[model samples]
Target: MTWTDDDPGQGEPPAILGLAKLRTARAQEIRRAQDTLTTASGDAGVGWQAQSQTAFAAEVQKTAGDVELLAVGMEKQAAVLTQYAGQLSQLKDRQRILEQRRASAKSSLARANAMMPGGLFSEPTPAPFVLAGEEDSTAEAKAEEEARQRAAAESKIAAAQADLRAIESEWDALVADRRRVDQSCSTALEAADILGAVSSFSGSAVSAASPGDLLDRLSVLSAIDLQVLLAAHPELAEKLQAASTQDVATWWNALDAEHQQTFIVGLPNIIGSLNGVSALGRVAANRINAANRLEAIERTLADWKRQAAQPGSFTNATSQISALEDEIKYLRGAVSEPPTVQLYLYDKDADRIIEMIGTPSPETKRVVTYTPGTLANLDGFYSGDTQSIADWLHKRDEDGMVAFVVKDGRYPQNPLTEANDQQYARGIAQNLADFEEVAFTDPLLEGRQSVAIGHSWGVANITVSEALGAHYDKVVSLSGAGAPADWTPSPTTEYRDFSYDDILQFAQDIRVGEHGAVWSGRNPREVGFAHEDYYDAPLTWKSFPGNGLVNPLLAAAGGIESHNLAASTAPGNLTLLNDMRDFINEAGAPR
Candidate 1:
């Protein structure tokens, strides 16, 4: 079923407000249980104490339920956030690479221009040498001298031509690089911005006063929160239900089927809210407009190229070309991309996945282990998301295997809940250990080489396993959590850290156990997304901003904005998948 949140009638609603309320409810239940337990323990009657114990048991179950729901919400939210961040990171990287290439081209162009015109290699005019009383040289001697001079001049001219040609080659290379970089950077940055904006919206939901407030902010919901909110405010839900449904459906039909499915599963609130649908439509329209602008500029460049090919057309085309480039660059910066979601597939069966990903070359045996941070889902799969990476690797690497392990082995049903930060970290570790055990046990994996790629929580999982004595070759963590003081990596551990958000619980938790020791002591490659930041020049969410729980409006805005950010660089995410495949091929390790 296509679920959408683009209905205008639904109004702006918080994406994760319902889950937050669920967490709050669990908290309340826990508090109530404690109170009853305390009172019962102080009572004289055993029967009353037993009753209290039973009640506590029931409360605990409810608490667990709440926790599960909340965890689901957190997981979903985390998935959305990571997807956006990862895509943005990719966009930033591509843009930087492209810009660097472009800059080199510009430098080469400058040199070439100087050499070609009246600059560096310009031919110098010779002045006649007239000695005061010197007789004129004989005609025959003068002619011979003139011939030699002519030869020398010709040689100098040839040399200059060669130099100019070399510079032109450099210029051409640079131009190509610049074009690639520009296009890639533009697309990626736009995607990142949109997703970032959505994330900003959701991030604000952390402090929503109630689920209703949050739902109102999301401006879309036909499920859970809206249902709950409707239960609370029957009149409002009833009044808006019919219009919201139609509006959401209409909006859903406008999007691609895949997107439609994603919207429903990930953004239930939007499906029920007409306003959310409208906002989403507006965002989509903006993305389309940006695409159109890019296309138009591309056409203009093509026309310029055609005109430049005509005799004397360079003079006319040059200035226009420069102007067009400037305009494209600006438009690229301005355009926003659609939101993207990451999908992480934990492939317990690597060989099959490997074959599924790439062309068949040989019967290869390999292992792939994936670990991801919070908020993962099947719904939010995108180009640069971990799953996309895996897909790329599968297609590109003919012989490699792949696998994934979710943070805490917990894919919460809801995307809103205070995470059991410790358990989540510990669980991923357990997952890795289990994989190792399985690898050793399986004939296919026995003696087969493997690599582990972890991001955020996944990094913790791999580190924890290594601490507990698991083995793997080349562990890469993308934007991993915990500092060197938190996770120590030695011979078996390799750390690749992405510089992103500040690590909070990860640092504290890794400080707890011997695993904590491992967490605290690893050197990671800290690559900054500054490349993208410099290019896209990310801005904070303007419409909504605050602790998500405290502000419904911000939370709602964050969700949409983050989605856009993730989507913008989604193409690069797809490229990453190819990189993964290439990595496998280069390693020549069987999957």
Candidate 2:
């Protein structure tokens, strides 16, 4: 049931290629719809067209243009994914070939070893003094042949093993490249603001007016008609779905106590996922959402398993079922966690999620929110290191601080991907901004200390969020790349950047955003950042506490690497822990 893409022949072929084809099909469908709209607009004439009719025709043309733009974006996305899938297919093929060679070499080595030193042709050897002509010529010949066979086997084995290692290295490179291409393609679509664009074009309606107007339109419909319309346009059914957080919060507050309770129960998905909504209300809403989603995924998983068991059926159904199982595991894991852990937001399909470690109440004095860099996914939400880190941060200030770990959709999984792209950070920044409004706008918590921590790519996300109006009193960067080169932070936001002898800084320019923001391609300790400070020398100890007689130079050289120091400094007495303790005191927050 392990759906691994890293091992060739172990799982299904790359599903990414299939996804690209699906997008292409959707684009074709949208293109056809756009053609129909354009043709209908052309068929209508000014002779019978009243003022309202003309306006309606113009709106139709506008919607057609929007649909056309969406179709183009999807086509572009499909093309990029297709190219990426081709590259992955090549890598997979190369891996399989090398594995076959390794297997053959191993078999050859085994056969060579089975040839005994004195096989079939064995005889007593004559001493030097004895008659040399009487020596066993057959034995000598057999020994020579056996020696050659052994040497040849060793040579072949070495070559095969080396080739296999090379393939593994290529696999790592592919993972990195996949992230770069994925981020670039996704950034373009996100910049176009094509959220649910395909759905909007594929018969789902989007209202041009306010939520109230949408409700008014729906209120008069018969029960049967309402059900059909709502099925097609669920976005319209939840009035709060399209509104800004501020507006939703205001509207929710204006409702009487009884009505607010009714809305929380009626539309838990919308109420729970909204920022600026009450903390407890969201927890209640999100719990219901998670339960419902988990139940549905379980049902689908059972069906997939049943299909997979049938003879001659696509065994690849196992991969699909395994993915659903992961989602279910993550969903149900919340029940086992501490009661304080809040399911702030969970959109499994979109791959965006937020989790809070504790209650964000008036008594809360400090808040620490962590945004991960790369190599993270929603599938591992509950069982990942994020919860461990959250617990660590929470323990730092048990009474006052609330810690949040956010995975704001998909992130570029490679450090070489160069996540300084504003596009990559923009969505995360918006989420952080909304989280701040929702978490800290209360009486005492509003004035409390807010700290934002970023490790690796998260550093860029935090800074971009700051630029986008996510206010934080302190920011800590752990081996993270900086934001845009020319971008400046407000004087109110204190920045603390930490970097060990990290080598990722050297590969920053390999794949960068259009803005071309890079990591300066030099050691942070030497060149230092053009914008932020590098404080590794003072915080990181040259020699640890108990290094009694060890060579000072050797001990210094044995220091931790950049990624480890950035990840967690809790154990092994690494250099980063000292800084973390200082930060816990300095920022008056932890986690």
lDDT of 1: 0.43
Model 2, 1-591: lDDT tens per residue?
Answer: 132345532323368778789989989998887777677666666565576667767867755655666677678777777776676566566667756765675665455444434433223344344365756865676567667765665565566566657656766665555455445654544443433322232222345667544433433333323333344457654554666656555555555555555455555666677665666667777877888887888888888888888898866876677778776777786544544446878777777888877776768877778887767676546566655555676776655877778886777665444364557668767776777767664433566788877777777777777667777878777776667443466667666666654444434444444423364332222233222343353223343455536665444444434354466644642446556646655744321
What TM-score does each of the candidates earn?
Answer: 0.29, 0.53
User: Candidate 2: lDDT of 453?
Assistant: 78
lDDT of 1 by residue, 242-280 (tens): 343334434444556455433444433324222324323
- Segments in model 1 whose C-alpha atoms lie over 4 Å from true places: 1-362, 377-386, 402-408, 411-420, 483-486, 498-569, 572-591
Determine which window of 10 residues in candidate 2 has minimal summed lDDT: 522-531
lDDT of each: 0.43, 0.61
As for model 1, its CA RMSD to the true structure in angstroms is 33.1
